[model samples]
Target: MSNSLFQPITLGHLTLKNRIVMPPMTRSRASQPGDVANELMATYYAQRAGAGLIVSEGTQISPLGKGYAWTPGIYTPAQIAGWRQVTDAVHREGGVMFVQLWHVGRVTNPDNTGGAQPISASAVKAENVKVFVDNGTDAPGFVDVVAPREMTKADIQQVIAEYRQSALNAIEAGFDGIELHAANGYLINQFIDSESNHRTDEYGGSLENRLRFLDEVVGALVNAIGAERVGVRLAPFTTLNGTVDADPQTTYTAAAALLNRHKIVYLHIAEVDWDDAPDTPMTFKQAIRAQFDGVLIYAGRYFTQQDQAAKAELAIASGLADMIGFGRPFVANPDLPVRLAQGFPVATHDPDTLFGGGEKGLTDYPVYQAAK
Candidate 1:
């Protein structure tokens, strides 16, 4: 039997070496003061360059778009230059990379946004959600998110412009493409999901109105960077960060069809991965494929070299997804593709050192050593 996950595949114009992807995971280790990507970030990504594609951590599009301390931004010239080094390192190791552009919307505290009120499609506050922020101490802390102000026509237009500029900045930084961070109850999710948005204007209430911000931002990105270089990540059945759509199936199917019209490169679905989390129904997967013709990538809990590995292979063999993303597995195994192909045992990452740390848990994980 052919090793389906080890085969080469075409993504946009680039050919990927395998069907394995290293999806975006925030380490919160960017340079202090500027939230810029640095040599450490570069080295971390380069260590995991064995994947077919590498989607970077959530990079805020503007200072005001920030939601966490120590996360990188893509708007400033220094930030762009910082990302260039990271991309150059990834390219040196023959890896394809895409930067995930992000805006937190109401998923932020005032401290993370320079004390400016966070803006969203509506002024509703996220319930029981907290964002990481600098607490005037060496270690950052999490604080409850404040209710965001409703975005005006001008605010919406300005944010769209920022997304366009950030897309251009990613291209200038040498990324193969860009992925809009529309998942995990961020800014875009704030608009697409019904529960968070309470506006009564043209940008709210009806499904189409709620989706208008997403449509406009996507259109701006597609116009700034070619549709072939654009991608969007959606969390269909997740209520993470308090984003629960009244009807997720209908919402996401329509989202897929909308992206299809733009001719974007891919539509990445972030399936709920936590223990006891409900699996995304196969029927919904079929519905998404029916609407979107581009490449599909699914991430979350697809383990390496075990029953889950077989499940990953089955997903590809059955045409459910073109590529499979192994998040936590790749964090501990840099040579993940080789290990997956050889049936090597995967290592566990340190949960204590998962975020806001240096090389200890980030780049210190070693490759699997086979028995001689």
Candidate 2:
């Protein structure tokens, strides 16, 4: 059977050669002292340019937005110049790339932010959640998240301004588009989830109010970069990082309707992939599609060529999704699209060096070679 995974698709004004996408996965390899992208990061992305579209790892929009150590940021001029190297490398290989703007909200400890308190939609803490941080000691490791201060109206406005500025910075760095990191229980997700948000202001309480932050940020990004060049990611059913909503279907469906009004480029769904993780029902998928009429992307644990190819084909053929994003697969298989298409053997990646590391696991993954 001929699969539609290799077919071309048009997203806004950008035409993707295939449906395979390289979604963002934090490598935590940014340069120290400045937390800026570097030539090593550029080489890593260039090696995986075989994907139809590449979404860079979650990049903090400002110093205060950072949660994990060594992740890249977009606020400083040095950081902007560093990211330019990455964008240039991907473009030289004829690949379209988007930077995922991020703010970790309460998903951090004071150790990671130079003693600054983490802020979120409310003062509530994410129970049992741990964040990787450097305590100015020997090595960096995981630490339990602390309670965050409730964001004031002024704080809210400043974050929105930062998002707008980050969008402009992304353009300055020569990216094809921008993908807001509203998923994975991050800053935006904290506001959207009822369990994490307990405010009575205009930015919380009712469902519409909770979505206000997302709406404002998206509007700002769309205004700065145009709706056609912007995308938003959501994790409706994911409980990762202590995010929980009373009714995910209702909440996320309403979110889809709201985003439909903006007519953004696409909606990327980050499906839960952990072992024994609950499956995303078709009802939710249908509800979201009914409300938002745009390209849809789904990313999860699909790895094998046989399974992923079949899933991708079914998704596009049935109008359920227009693209499929492969995360961990791209970590080991830089030329994953070619390997999947040609039935080549894929390499395994080391989980130990998945986060902060040097060139060993970052750029040393070998491309597929035929057995002689």
Q: Could you tally the backbone clashes for each prediction? A: 0, 0
Q: Which residue pairs overlap in candidate 1's backbone?
A: none
Residue 306, model 2, lDDT: 50
- Quote the lDDT for 257 in model 2: 91
Model 2 score (lDDT): 0.90
Alpha-carbon RMSD of each model: 1.2, 1.3
TM-score of 1: 0.98
lDDT of each: 0.90, 0.90
| Residue 151 of model 1, lDDT score | 91
Worst 10 residues of 2 by lDDT: 302-311
Q: Which portions of model 2 miss their true places by more than 4 Å?
A: 135-139, 305-308
